[model samples]
Target chain A: MNFDEIYSSKLALVEDALKKLMERHKECPPTLFKAMNYSLFAGGKRIRPVLLLSAHELVGGNVEESMALACGLEMIHTYSLIHDDLPAMDDDDLRRGMPTNHKVFGEGMAILAGDALLNLAYEVFLENAMKYPYKLERHVRAAFVIARAAGLHGMIGGQVADLEQEGKDVQPDMLYYIHTHKTGALIEAAVRAGAILEPIEGDVEDAVAKYGQKLGLAFQIVDDILDVTGDAASMGKNPSRDEARKKPLFQLCMAWGNRGVWHGT
Target chain B: MNFDEIYSSKLALVEDALKKLMERHKECPPTLFKAMNYSLFAGGKRIRPVLLLSAHELVGGNVEESMALACGLEMIHTYSLIHDDLPAMDDDDLRRGMPTNHKVFGEGMAILAGDALLNLAYEVFLENAMKYPYKLERHVRAAFVIARAAGLHGMIGGQVADLEQEGKDVQPDMLYYIHTHKTGALIEAAVRAGAILEPIEGDVEDAVAKYGQKLGLAFQIVDDILDVTGDAASMGKNPSRDEARKKPLFQLCMAWGNRGVWHGT
Candidate 1:
């Protein structure tokens, strides 16, 4: 399939998976589950899980094997986003063209939603492991990859660095480290996870991982570019908020020296 | 060995393991490493890791294997404590006897320290998996146990519930759920992980898990009791802070309705 078609197809699968997952949580407290589903169902690119699925496909892995893994990655990504938007974190009021989780659900409920999502992510992964017909080795490897990506060395590490650099002129090396670990780590794990499941070896796994790494960084850079140039409506939130906060984006742009990059917003 | 002597010896071993882990981070920024070590070294009971080691001994598992697992558990625990004390989370000024991480280090550094410790925990586990002379299955199973305990279903779930109930009167069932999931999950995992490594089953494993569950709950309840009656200096922090903040503890105690019962602090 062409890129657009492929992306659309992958997203459809993700939407279906998410629908099933959210439905499972309905037996939980109604308001709490609704708030959880609100941010989860809120639109995003589903890039990490898609990367996982696509990489699995490329490696001749069964889509069945990847389905839960994809969903788990998305759960984690979504949870992080929810937490990141908390008043204690990014304090964003809008995301993906709608109110942020805390904005709609209140901070307390939003926090629970994020917590439930994080918990459910692992539960889903464990459930997948129990169901998968594969050897225990593959499941273990997958767990390690997912954990590393989600934990400090990968996404959380990046977040820590990113938070540290807030409102400061960060070095280029620090910026790269932040982006690679924080954003790229999860993306890389998505691709690598697929490869691991399929038992791909040698250069193929490495190549896919590299692709993910590059794409993740490119994605962040595009976000930066968009924050500078894209319309608030198109971007789904306030475009100038990052600038107003004097976040590291300004330092990154200055390092790139890209003035007048946007003619219109 | 008696419990006191064994505890002291295990503490020494844990200290060594923590020292080695901190040494690995020396190449990173000193401020970041120092903050990470500060929390790691800050004296807590080391209950989770100690339980793991004791369970391993009870099962006749290798001490080295148990030690590795214990170290990993401690790292996860320490990191969670650091994050838990953040201005956005509990906003505590003290943990154990020392200033909370964010108080000594800025909020940003404290955040990164937690992140780094979390990553290092996983790294240590991965290394153990690689080095184990036993079958990969055992290591993988152990790793899964740790991940499950540390991840959303375990500690993170409890944290979310605790945060959700902040400034609210929580029912006994809700309080039980929070404390069990938060504190009990990891403790149970510690015991179970040691058993998993040794390849035991039947009532033995179940008994160990049950013991851990009860012990974990008992520990938390005792902590609650301490907060109400313990000396601040002896406890190493403000014991009454929980009550002052109108946290869920008072509600929990009232729900239990054991005002006459006293567990020695």
Candidate 2:
């Protein structure tokens, strides 16, 4: 498939999965669920789950087997974004061309929405494990991988570093460490989990992992690049907003021998 | 062993396990590690881990084998507390008689510390699965159970309900739902995990589950009782804080025919 075709297909699957997941929460607090759906349904690339599914496909695994995990990964990513936008965190009033969750739902409900998403992510996985016609070991491995990547030493660790480095002239190495762990870890775990579930062996697993590492870093770099160069309307969020707030960026543009050069953004 | 002796021994073991787990974060950001240590060491009853250990003992399982899971449960609980104390959530300024994490470390760092503890909790479990002397299946099952309990249909779900109900006069049924899912789920998971690892069978598992359900509700009722009756100084916090804030109380008090009576102070 062409890039758009592949991207569109993955997006459709993710959207359907998320819609179904949110439907289950219909009877939950209506306002809170609305806030959750607002952020969850907000447009994004769905890169993490797409990459996971792609990795699974590369390993000859059926996408259906990894569907629950893919959706869970996206839920986590969405939940973090919701919390990160809270006034206590980034204080952003807008995301994806819409009001941030806390802005629309009030802070308390927003917090609940983020929390609900996190919990629901795992619930989706467990339900799948209990119901899917797959080997229990695969589900167990997937669960472990997702938990590790999402938890302390993975995305959360990166987040800690990122938050800590705010308003400071964070070193390139520190920025790299933060991004690689914060975003890169989960992306890596996503791919790894997919491969592990499919029982991919040896070099293929290593190759997919390498691909994930590169893609994750590349994705973040592209985001940095976009923040500097992309249109706010097109991106559905402000570019250069980080700079406006004096937040650290992973890239630096410098002149090198009369040539413009970009360092870590 | 007598109850006190058993409790003390179990507490001691859990303390040691927590120390070991904390050591793993030594290379983490010093501020983050300090924040994490402040709360992890601030100390509560360590009741959840203690329960898990006791259950393991009752099942004839080696406490050593289940120590990691015990620590994991405590980490999860501690992380929730740290997050709950945030300005956006419960907005507390004190915990366990000391300044709350955010008060000491600032909002950003406190948030990160909570996140790190959560991630580290899973990391500890993963390490156990990899290195523990048990069958892989057993470790996987244990990890899966813990993850599910901590996720949506478990602790976080209850938290969402509790958060949403903060200002409203929630029904008694709704109150039960919140506590049972929020606090009781993990408590149940802790005991269930121990039993799972110990390979406890049939009615024994069912019995332990029933005991856990009652114990968890009783524990919450006693907490509510203390919140009303205990000295704010001795309780290390306000005793009537829940009523002052209009938060839900356990229904056990109503069962005693004391519908509107506040207990502790």
For lDDT, the strongest prediction is 2
Give the Å shift of residue A5 in candidate 1: 2.6
Chain B TM-score by candidate, in order shown: 0.90, 0.90
Which residues of candidate 2, in runs, are more than 4 Å off? A24-31, A126-135, A244-265, B130-138, B240-252, B255-265
Error of 1 at A222 (Å): 1.7
lDDT of 1 by residue, A1-265 (tens): 8999999998999899889866764654456677778877888789888888888899888777788889888877887788777665666888899989878877656655665665566556655665653454575467568877886657776776666666676677787777777788899899998888866767887888778776776788887677777876888876646453335566765643443222211
Give the Cα lDDT of each candidate. Answer: 0.73, 0.75
Encode model 2's per-residue lDDT on A1-265: one tens digit a residue. 8999998898798789878867775765556667778888898778888888888887888888888889988988998888777776777877898888888878767766776677667657656765644466567567778887786667777777777776777666676777678788888888888888776667887877777776677777777777777875888776645563233342322211122112312
User: Candidate 2: deviation at residue B203, Å?
Assistant: 2.4
Q: Give the DockQ (C-alpha) for candidate 2.
A: 0.41
Native contacts kept, each candidate: 0.20, 0.42
CAPRI classification of candidate 2: acceptable
Task: Write the residue-wise lDDT of candidate 2 on B1-265 in tens digits.
Answer: 8989989989998898889778865875678888989999997789889888888888898899889989988988988888888777778887899998989998867766776676577667766766654455676567677777776557776877777777677677677777778888889888888887866677898778767876777787877767766875787755534453344443445743343223311
Clashing pairs in 1: none
How far out, in Å, is residue B126 in model 1?
A: 4.7
Error of 1 at A246 (Å): 9.5
